[model samples]
Target chain A: MKRDLALLLGILLALLAALLLWALHATLALEPGPRLAELASARLEQTGVSNPVTAVLLNYRAYDTLLELAVLLAALLGIWSLGPAPAGYQRSGPALAALVDWIVPLAILAGGYMLWVGGHAPGGAFQAGALLGAAGVILRLSGEPSAGLPGEPAQRWLVVLGAGVFALVGGGLLASGFGFLTYPPGQAKWLILLIESAATVAIGVTLTAAYVGGRPGSGTAHNGTGQSRTVQR
Target chain B: MADLLILPVLVPLLGGLLATALPVRSALVGTLAALATSLSGLSITLLVWLHGDLGTVLGGWGVPLGIGLSADGLSAALLAMASLVALAISIYAGSYFAGSAQARHFWPLWLLLWSALNGVFLAADLFNLYVMLELLGLSAAALGALTGKREAIAANLRYLLVGLLGSLTYLLGVALLYTAYGTLDIGLLGERLGPTPIAATALALMVSGLALKTALFPLHFWLPPAHANAPAPVSAALSALVVKASFYLILRLWTELFAPITDIGAATLLGLLGAGAVLWGSWRALRAQRLKLLAAYSTVAQIGYLFLFFPLLASLPPGTARDDLFAACVLMALTHGFAKAGFFLAAGLVQQKAGHDRISELGGVAQRMPATTFSIALAGSALVGLPPSGSFIGKWVLMRGAFETGQWWWLPVTVLGTLLAAAYVFRVLSRAFGLEPTPLQFVTNARTEIPALLLAFASVALLGLAAGPVWAVLGFGAAPA
Candidate 1:
């Protein structure tokens, strides 16, 4: 009886505390301050980029993209080193292949739209590329002969090339007495767009590679072929 | 300039995505990931120190509409510590699981962890911080599940569930703040926040949510089982990094926002619970059969020491008292980070050699694995706050600070925690001395023992090194307590 009474008291105290906090919040009349919706449009004008979000992702926050590249490349290399195992010997079913036939094109279209519209919309390189990568995985899982990642050499070159181009372009700007990754005053738009395009390819390929663990043509691929698991971006 | 803050987080994330794509040589991918992350950490630490606070004008839109990443001194320090431990763990793990099947994905998960940790530290905006924290929780759970045992899977699932609940509560707090205040940037919130009822409620919600995430006893149901069952490197990272990050935020919020009200009565409540955790955890650790469980329980006890600072510091009025108070907290953080990481690594070596971490059967194990044994002992010494270790100095400062401020109760709590630590350390060490009547034989490879020894030695020498620049670095620039 004592224990039960104590428990009830504890519960009541908790309820009282909750009610008190709620009352405090109600009396204070809190609200979200400001939403910088106009700044996105304004930034597009300043950077001369059609999509402010894209400009931000590829230009303003390019370092994040850079580190992301490092992660993908690292995963790819790890999978590459461990390839040619018996685990990569599974065959995909015909039904899955048929599904990929339709889904792949749609995925590509959506990915492209996301990249293009990211300047003003909610989607960007990361989301679009991830969706495209999902399509690639679907094709591979569905038994498409070339559904998987490309050869190691080609994949490595592609991954490096994206970072290479960004770095090289940025390096030139550095040489011009600005700084690393500084887009020239008037050319920020095109430079930003160009970087996003490369990132799209790199991001798409990277996500796909992480899932597939290398391309189909690249000697028995190793990585991603574990006891099948679903992946998310 | 602000954008650079986000790069450290993004690079590993992108790399994690690409690591899945890499064919063959998956370990190499993980190695590269570690390299990239370490580089990012080092550069960011240097940059932040050289310049000042770093933040991102995310999405070409500043805070409110778009997210942002920021690194102040606190974030930089935590980032540096996380990077160092991750680098060490990666090196040790490289050879530890060299030919294992999961090595391919190990690097990917690790990179994911790296990104999550960095993101959590750099996140300037509230929503982003919540997202990063969730990512960290999920990835940590996934990493724990990698061992592929029924126990590991179950523990990880439980951890995930509890972690999600914590995150949900924290998210709700964020919503409340958004509903109450206008901004999410911690700095902006600090400036805009008045001592209003709504603001106070928001603070309460946020603190409680973070406290739950940090697992301050009563709420720490998910920590021990999950931490004990995980693989060595994973356990080390989780204990030394993941939980600490949440606490880091709590500390930040306290120093930044709640300093005024904390002196009233709320801080005392937290300290009281902390005192309980110290006793409960130490008592459990002394009685645990498994080395891993012992270590996990020790973490509970160690965490108690961190909370003691709040009440102790708040009791002090302004001036040098505050400076010493904050310094003690920082020292405590640094020492715990190193010592716990070393302890976990040592425990890993023991488990690998014996095939089980059962303490009773570990007799005469020290004969073969002296390095690992030494490492464990040194780490244990630090954990116990024994003389000549970083932990000793940290505890001494804290004790003195407490006494100077008239918080005499902390003395008993600290002393009791120390005694319990000593008892447990001796329990492990005495068993290692071949005194057990039913002693079981053991042998361990040198490869595993070296990293453990290095980390342990580092913990021991940490205090000595601090006399130089590291000591100066302690209070280089800060608002004191």
Candidate 2:
């Protein structure tokens, strides 16, 4: 019965894919009228960022990005609520530790570079944050507990930093009679950089905490049963 | 005035962040934030009431390039209902999870979910709605699993996965629409959309996705366990607000955005599924062993009733009759929002007192906690479409619509669902009247009991006795003419 069900589902999925492709083809075949691309490029300079993607993310559609950060924080909080982190792996060998010693610093430096170049280039907060998070993961694999993250209290503040700063800036703007998230004239670049910097730190911390897979603590307060369920990755 | 539109979403968001950072003071911050958020939402509703409609593009960027927030009559009516229900839930939660580790986690996630709910009601961009939906889904699922029990965890995990799939499907439809029309703004898309095959396909995909999330029959398998196994406060939010958010989306899409392409045949198909849900869900609720489970199944039936209006709406010509039908649909939704939240809150108190919510075992709870029992009775009456309940008016309109539209086949479904609803509600009430030592006062633990009682009273008295406001808020002229 299970096999039959699976086969039926597979067939249905195939049909759906075919239908979706056809629909996409029909949709794209229409006159690709004036889209946001033209409008975004036309008003690019006013956004204070050369990169249109950054302009959209940080300036025009910043509300969505702010909520996306909240989504990230919510996910990490969900993980933490399950319980504290399990025991870390065994200590790494001298060679592995040495490799981490070199790679971690280089990753951090690259992350900073990415954050800086994000104004006019491909790298940005999310990418830079991912690099920093990778470094944390490497540190964890080398047997560092907590993924080298701070204590619980500081970790809490770090996870919310991105969304908090973004909201604060927006609210400040609104209070000053500018629309929410509306950067002041001649100040959009600096504001975007500030928001992006905070976001990078927040994203990095959130990703690392996620990799740790649970709350960062000694596990004394939480229920004892959670330990058995915690997978040691 | 339009600039104030963002506060409903902003206040709760900042509150969530604050609550996360200051875990020790989360409850206080969360409660204050809930108050502020409700005020902002209610004020927005009031503004829309006084001033027709309000719209604002964020960051001063114009539409088709920037996201817009708009509050129309439809959104404002729902927003008013959501604000009141959410504030009551927040109060109930302050007591429900008091002095537990869960309280710290619950407040932050709960506030985040509130922000998303507000975002959904006001968002003018389809993609922004998608983002809001994701945030709502994630926080709701997480909040549902706060109990840490195996069943709760398993059920919520399934819910999370299902919600993600639904959002992805919806996003695909959004992408399709954006690709075709080159805009994500709902207003712009509505103006540009035609009766094209791609438009139909996009509608199908989007409605299907939303239906899955809304737990529209046949696709409602994941809702029962997920809702029933959740902590009570979470269960109330899930049943009352979360499901309604998705249904609200479907209603907007069906009646406004997709109206140009939507045919009566498709609307009838939805009504048929709704009929199935009404019967199936009510039958299941009638047989449910536990109170929360019964409430969950009843939510399924209630949602079914909401969809039953689609066909009637499609068949009606554009005029006061159609407008009245639309207002009735919104009234039914608002009534359910209050009734279900009240039912779940009261049930939560009963469960806490008794250590279990098995319907057969709840005998003396009514006598001991008269206020809570009364809440349940009142909320259950609204569910059963009793006299003077908002749903009573809702059903009256529904049956009348059925007759006028010649969709008389739906009459039997409505009557049978109402009968089953009464049977289930009375089954619990019967348990409540059993011999036991009665308390002297009506309310015990005013913090918890009052919110439930007020919500139940709102559904029965406030909404039913004075439904003119609902019509007025919907801009259908006072008293439905």
Candidate 3:
């Protein structure tokens, strides 16, 4: 009875929240996005940045993008620094290899298409990255660590690409003639496309680096006991 | 200016990232990360003081597009106190985790907690602030339960539930406001919100939810055990910073979101709860025999000083001689923040040194460690509102204003709380000085005393700093002085 009551209450609360959200949308007279956002978003059309959402995520909301990239970097560093369960590495396969082979190429193709289609519609670099990351995770589960920690220079370059590139663009915009991240009046779409492409590459690699940092025997071993966080998972 | 504003978050986050990435132990990296974060926070706060309001736009974002972070006089003062307290606690935590195998879990959560703290301070948007608050609540709960004992787990579970409930309530209110006004940006919301029923209800829900999290007297049932049962460094962090952050939000949101809903009855109700918290917390603290429990209860008392700002809101309205109430509350929060962290650190040291923290058995313990005693006494002095401590200056201004404004009732409550604080603070100190027949030989580090001393000295110096800058940054409808 108690369990059922809790379930019922939770559902009620969720429904109420949904109703509230609907009412809010109705009352706030919520419009499509905003004119400025729409105007800025149009930059994707000219730039040819494969993924529009990725372009928006990486360029339009680049500040948050930079931070999110940092979070990914932090996660990777967390695995490396904390050291992990010794020999926690395992590669699993069954009929899985055959299935994975069939899915992997299709995923990549879909991801690439999504990346290309993002300019005109909802797809973009982030969706491509997610699909790519999913492939990486599957690969890791199949024995490979999914990515390699390159030389210090490569690592440093990759890590700073998001913030560094954003800064360079904004600084250049201000330094040249436009304000900040502003294009040459008519070339907003092309400039935005450039920024988005770089952002996608930077975000993808950084996230991969962070994700791979969690594997066993990579550096997490004998890392002091201070880095653990038990989320009751 | 942007560098200063962003460093507080950047250093910790970078340190946290590095700590995770470093080939060394994650726990050690976390401590180093915390140390780096505190040092950065300290320098940033100092920079804010020197440069004037430190403002930064993330990826150069601003207004409605990108996020903006500003550290004015008020944030600088509070942040200075917070960072110093966090730094000392971090050092104490160093000794704490060295022997424990569980250190790895400590750094990530600690770093995350630090990140959340920085996030709250630097957040410029309402939704961003909500996200940071949620992060803070989650990290604090995880930290609380790190000990994994049944009681600790239970305490942490309760804390997590309460925290999530509070956040949900706050979110619910925010959603209502968004429905009513169509924006989640604080600056935008303020301009949009006027004398509307929706706005009034939103403020009520937000404040009540915040008050629950702040552990204001009626809603303070969850704090004592949660703080008391956690590991010492964790305890210090939770009691000194976690609860206060929620209050800081309340104060910030009060000025930003609820400025228009200036209700007299509501103000009195909040003040009444605050006054009750003072008497109730101090009373319970006096009864607690366990040193840490006693210190934990004292936190409840300190929290009351924050709410005194509500009632005095009118007296300190614009075009006035800065209602001394505002100064009083900020002073009280800052003083409590430092002195309480010091007290917890010292209490932890005592527990470590004596094998237990029995107040009665602490006799003659002070003779062997004068530095620790000096720390406790100094921290206690601040708690008692004695001269040469920040709380003294805060209470002095508050008392002066209370009488001058002819609201004499608050004066008694302030003095009463001061007396009660003195009683409890001195009680522990006096016990430490006892000439008992037996002296326990528990192991303690000489370095342990430093964190407590740092906190004590900070509280002492804060008393001497000029207040003009402090109020200027509060900027609660007032322009920078």
Candidate 4:
């Protein structure tokens, strides 16, 4: 009965989607102009960055980006709450370990480059952070426990660095009567860079910690018992 | 003053980050943050009460380009309710998670969730609302799963997935709106919106997505387990505040942004779903074996009552009648926010004292904890719309609206739902009155007990008796004659 109900609901959902698509097709035929894009480009000079995307992301709607960082932090904190990380794999053979050693440093260098080029080009903190995160994952697969993350105390600070710095900057701006996240004239570029740099480190650390899949270190021994209780249930 | 609107969202966010960094001092940081957030929120409400409305574009960019934050009568009223209820929950949590391993995890995530709730209330940009919703969903699900129970984990995992889907669907609708209108600001879109098919489709999509998150009837399957299994304070926030945030958005969209596109048919469909929810949820609460589960189911029923206003609101002409009905709707939501939080907190205490919350076995513990029992009873009265409770006023107005519009069918549903609510509330209260030795003291565990008692009192006395201020906050001047 449940399976049949699911199938019926699926069909109904498909019909709804089709109807929505038809409506959208008729609406788009009216040809809404690229007004927002033009506006962003027109105002790009006022923003610190040359990239229109960054202009909107960091200056125009910076509040959204700040909250997005908080969302990332929330996700990482959620992962940490589950329990301690599972044991790492046995030490990798020398050849794979050597490969990981070479790849990790190179990935870090590339990540730095990506972060630098984001001001004028396509790469930004997120892409750079992903590379850094990949480097940490490689280290973990090579049998480094903690996934190349520092101890729990340092890990906490690193994870919050992005959102913490972003919020502090915004708050400081607000206090200075510039409004929240509103950069001062001629300082928008440097401010965006500083915020992006902090976000990159935080995102990279958060992603690596999330890859570890649980809380780090010896402080969370209580959750071990809680995990066993779940098993018993 | 307009710039102060961002403080409510910012203060808690900074606190969450600080709490995340300083695990040992997390509780202290969380408490301070909660206090600051509530004060900032209430101040915004005060400012709105003094001034008509306030709006600001972040980064000094004009609307349609930059994100904006705004506070009007509707947002201010909900903001004030959320502030008080959250402050109470934070106090209750300070005791509930005291010295536990979950304290560090709970503080940061709870603060983050509070920040998102504020963000949702103040946001004037559609995409910004989506971001706030995602943050709210993520933190809420994480907090709900804090118990580490198998059922809690499973239920919250489902909740997280469902939330993501809802946000994505809502985002799709937003993308369509941007495509059609070239703006994401609520005020700008409202000005530009016409009765176009795209606008209609976007409204449908957005409302449907928000309905899932709000747990409107058929989409509420995940809510009961997720809410029932969470640690009590988390459950209180989930049931009381988080669901209402999404419903607030739907109300804003329907009456403010999508008014030209909205019609009686869609509103009636929503009302019918609400009727289904009222019956199904209240019936389930009556059948629930556990105290927490009963409270969770009651939330589903309470949300149904809020939606019942939509059909009436759609049909009512712009006059004092419509204005009064809207105030009553906001009153019902605020009362439920306080009442449900109180109910869940008291239920948690009962569960703690008894080591289980099984309703059938609660009589002894319920008798032992007099303060807790009283809290439950007060909250239950509000839930059942008893005399001199805020929901009584809400129901009176709801029924009046129904009669005024000649939609008399809703009156029967309203009546039946109320009867069911009374039955379930009395059933629980009856457990408290069982023949066990009465506690010598009326108050115990002042830290926790007082918060629950105060919340319930607010629902019954503050809201029920002095609801005139609710209209004043909503800019409706005085209470309806």
Whole-model Cα lDDT of every candidate shown, in order: 0.70, 0.93, 0.68, 0.92
> How much lDDT does candidate 2 score?
0.93
C-alpha positional error of residue B419 in candidate 4 after TM-score superposition, expressed in Å: 0.7
- Tens-place lDDT per residue, model 4, A31-53, is 77446888888889989898777
Query: Per-residue lDDT for A147-226 in model 2, tens only?
Result: 77888889899999999999999999999999899889999999999999999999999999999888877545455545
**Candidate 3 C-alpha lDDT tens digits along B91-164:** 77877777675565566667767877877776666666666667677777777777767887788789879987
lDDT of model 2 at position B109: 97
lDDT of 2 at A209: 93
Model 2's C-alpha root-mean-square deviation from the true structure amounts to 1.7
DockQ (Cα-based) per candidate?
0.15, 0.83, 0.14, 0.77
lDDT-based ranking, best first?
2, 4, 1, 3
Question: For candidate 4, lDDT tens digit of each residue in B392-478?
Answer: 999999999999999999999999999999999999988888877776754379999999999999999999999999999888867
Off by over 4 Å in 1: A1-32, A38-41, A47-111, A114-233, B1-20, B32-73, B258-263, B436-447, B464-471, B474-481
Q: Which digits, one per residue and each the tens of the lDDT, describe model 3 over residues A66-89?
A: 455544444443343334422323
Candidate 4, residue B343: how far the Cα is off, in Å: 0.6
Q: Taking the tens digit of each residue's C-alpha lDDT, what string does model 1 give over A114-199?
A: 87777667887678778778887776566443345566557655665555566556556655645546666788777766777777
lDDT of 2 at B297: 100
Residue B132 C-alpha lDDT in model 3: 67
Instruction: Tell me the tens digit of each residue's lDDT in model 2 across B260-371.
Output: 9999999999999999999999999999999999999999999999999999999999988888889999999999999999999999999999899999989886668888
Model with the higher DockQ, candidate 3 or 4? 4
Clashes of each: 43, 0, 25, 0
Question: Model 4, stretches more than 4 Å misplaced?
Answer: A1-10, A218-233, B439-443
Question: In candidate 1, residue B262 scores what lDDT?
Answer: 52
